[model samples]
Target: MLIKSVFIILLVGLFCQTSYAKDNCPTRKPVICYWASWAVYRPGQGAHKIENIDPSYCTHIIYTFAGIDMDGKLTSLDNHNDIVNGGYKKIVALKESNPCLKVMLAIGGWNEGSEKYSLLAETEESRKKFAEDVSRLMINYGFDGFDVDWEYPTQRGGIPADKENFVALLRALKERLKPRNRILSIAVSASVAVSKQAYDIEAICREIDFVSLMGYDMQATNATSIHSPLKLESSDPDDRETLDQIVYYYKSQGCPTQKIILGVPAYGRSFTLQNPQNNHVGAAVLGVGREGTFTREAGFLGYNEICDLKRTRSDWRNEYLERNAAVYGSINKLWVSYDDPKTIVAKAQYVLEENLGGMMIWSIDTDDFKGRCGQSAYPLLQAINKGLGNQLPSSFSHVDF
Candidate 1:
């Protein structure tokens, strides 16, 4: 009896140690951030470049974008200037600052539409040629991988054949990239309608390294509601979107938890409230919100401008909705909904609880790149990193990538 009791005690100790190790392990998932090349030309609000980026913030950076040429080949979108002026080389050089940082070229954005991709994926010949071109581009540009940003597969001016053709394109690219050990990833929509009608989740999971889920933009210009709620609030309608629902939908469709990256926005959706007194979640809106100082967009505000507004405007008051795990502010008729550091931390906690791969920011340029927000530079990113246990070293600048 004495020997048996000792054996049981040892077993319990072993179990506790194993549990602690599993709980405290470093995050093995990738925190991906997208960097827009065109932001360099956006005057005051959009003057961001590869050099402005903090190498420690993200595990992977995707340069957006390289367009599809007339002959279905990968081509530089910036008037061919990015290629000639060594912009691609500058992006690749970032690895010198953070060797663990993987750089990828993202092809096709919303502006590129689905027409070109539909045609490119229609035939085996086109898919093969496109894959070869992408592989060649990666080799020449020193990119670690490529990400496909197809807006939608079966819909969005695409044919029914796109469902299978999309898979074929991924397969072709994977096969071509396998020898070089390069990664292949894709950006997917989080809309329930598109999610159900579009992606072949299981097949895609089988072919790609990871899926960057565009989980924001749930609320469009036409509606005034929470843009990216962690969960639906009481005031939210039945059809209202939430990040939890988006994540679950993908997981249920057979996407592995570790292969999914939750995308967060570094911007906000603004709405011009019809009645200043009725400033609430489902208030009536009068068209888009007023244009922002830097973004110069009617319904959008970057984190920098948003923080500036909260700081300067007397009417602006921050409101944290606990149930929804979202933050928003109102100043009379002007209301802006965005994720603050606290909300980001909560979402990052959600990422860990769900055992997700990691979080992805839409465009790091939209972040408080100048560190004027007072919570340290990249406050939103810092919260995420801390929540995921991937904190940046206090003296990270000492080491080159």
Candidate 2:
């Protein structure tokens, strides 16, 4: 009778665990998805509204960009969309569907620059005031917390003191958020060159809930290269720019495994080939590729647009780079290096292998959320969830950084 009871208890526990895994598709890893507010302006099928978001797909959905006012207070950059239209309340309402969802807001993007943030962090009084103001916004708007996206604190017209001061600012913000149990995260550059100059990783990690590492954009060159390669080849000149290198760098610098959130792009980086025949990885480029029909960005192509190209264009062809674990598609003189489901799966597997926090998509809006690709709505995002739920073999090992 004792043995039978023990057996029954074990079976019940196993059944419950299996049920939890199936019900929670993404398992324990958080899928942090950034929702760019401007994506609503994207024409036709590309236009993604706050309602389009499926809160179940993401653990945390951050509203991109609230900015610092000249007076050093938190302010909305888009009053019409963010405030007048009740964007904040609508986004927070997503928690109604998935109570586990953390709706966060980001302040400072590439356009927001670093000068004002540097100034805002120079004094304790200003930092405290800014934190209080941010806390107020979080409380008022029902945001879980805010993300500090100061693009390279000590670079791009910022004072050198920003490196340490950035830490101070985060500490103050964390203090304000901690009492209320709100989250505090920062989007940081993945490049070793920029990271070393801009951040003291150890110090920053100590104060924040997590670090959103912008692992893409390592392909800033005249030649064609993968924008967000998963792994680095020893022969590659920019090996330090790969996702593996950045993750390793942060880990080496004492960032906890759970505190590092690796980022992946929902868009691809494009280049206009100088010679149509020389369409290889290092092929010379004339300039940025033609803009997408919907995104209308000269050098970038959203995953949705890429799907359109694959479906509509007869000449479109793709080649996989096994070494880097990335893919590139070419049509005539236009060449784009981008991530598809395969790439995302590999990265997700890496996240699991490393026991990292989770995966973050740059902007969820750019993903194919309309099912126009004949696969599924939000195909890339679905792939991320799928990968995160996968169980790799015991023999699987991570590549050397």
Candidate 3:
């Protein structure tokens, strides 16, 4: 009788342990969303606030970006918005609605440049100081982790030693964050040429939670082309790089497939054709396309801006680069290449087929969150969520256009 009782207790304990492990482990792939703080400044319909974000749309939200000072310490670039006005506090509060959602603070961006990050990573003392400063800021602000967006470690005015030092910097940050159960991730360029010069792929992969591959903005030359293509388009040169080639290159370099998060753009790159009739890809371009009313930046248009153009105008011709898995629009002299819901779904399916970690949106702010284009709100993100085999929560199940 005593032996039987002991056996039963052991069996129960084993079952409980197994159940606990299964329950704690993440069952679905992550949907990482980046929220740009600057979107608050956009006028009228283009302005995106912290409240506009749907917590259900993302598994992880990264706030970009917190700047690094000359002293190698983490600092808020926009104090009035980020700290004084409770931007960080409000974004972190999203966890109340999404218990599984992880929020991280990103440091460095294209505007911040690479030289500052290079100098910061050049010494152990600076790296240690930066890591500690990051930890304190995260702890105080309730951020779950840190995201390093150094652009490219060894280029953009950065030194050659940045290749090894980049890995060292991540190691230091990882060591500091691990004890607190926090995470660390990086955003890396997708270009093979750039990756070769900037990263020690295998080493960097081993240290961080995942690599966010900037799969967009990879136009080969000044010629008008699809900014982000899943595969080489029929019109593309044989040597032109695509998202497919980018993934294969990273994997061949020893980065695990599951550790790579494919980036999807929520904006489009635009070019002004020299002749309105010559609006196809590889056509001649005189300069950047005209800016949007809200975004007000030449050569770029938010998905919201693009969709507005499509909705209000009747003359624009839209085409899907079927072979490449991308889409484009041309009206008069304006040519813009961007991803729509259909293409976003295609990318998400590719994510599952390739066993990638997840999808990372360059930003959620640029998406048509208000549903002004006569489609469901967050159509692109919704496509990604559903394509990844997950359903929207009961609260947001009723999508509005």
TM value for model 1 = 0.90
State which candidate has the highest TM-score: 3
User: Which 10 successive residues of model 2 have the least lDDT summed?
Assistant: 392-401
Clash pairs, candidate 1, are 96-401, 97-401, 98-401
Give the winner by TM-score: 1 or 3.
Answer: 3
- Give a tens-digit lDDT track for model 3, residues 289-356: 89997789999999999999999899989989876778989999999999998999899999999999
- Report clash pairs, candidate 3: none
Residue 255 in candidate 2 has what lDDT? 96
**What lDDT tens digits, residue by residue, belong to model 1 across residues 1-401?**
99999999998988776566435533445789899888777677457877899877888999998889657888888855487667899998887766567899999999888888999999999999999999999998899999999998887799888988899999999999989989999999878778777788889989999998897878756657778888888777788778888899889989899999988889999999899888877778997788877778898988888998877888788888876778888898888888878888888889999999999988788888888867578888787788787856443333321
Residue 183, model 2: lDDT of 95
RMSD of each: 9.5, 8.0, 6.0
Best by lDDT: 3
| Global fold similarity of model 3 (TM-score) | 0.92
Give the 10-residue window scoring lowest on summed lDDT in candidate 3.
392-401
The local distance difference test score of each candidate is 0.84, 0.87, 0.89
Models ranked on lDDT = 3, 2, 1
lDDT tens digits by residue: candidate 2, 264-381? 9999999999999999888999998999988898999999999899999999999988767789999899999888888888888899999999999988898988889875688888
Return the candidate ranking by TM-score, descending.
3, 1, 2
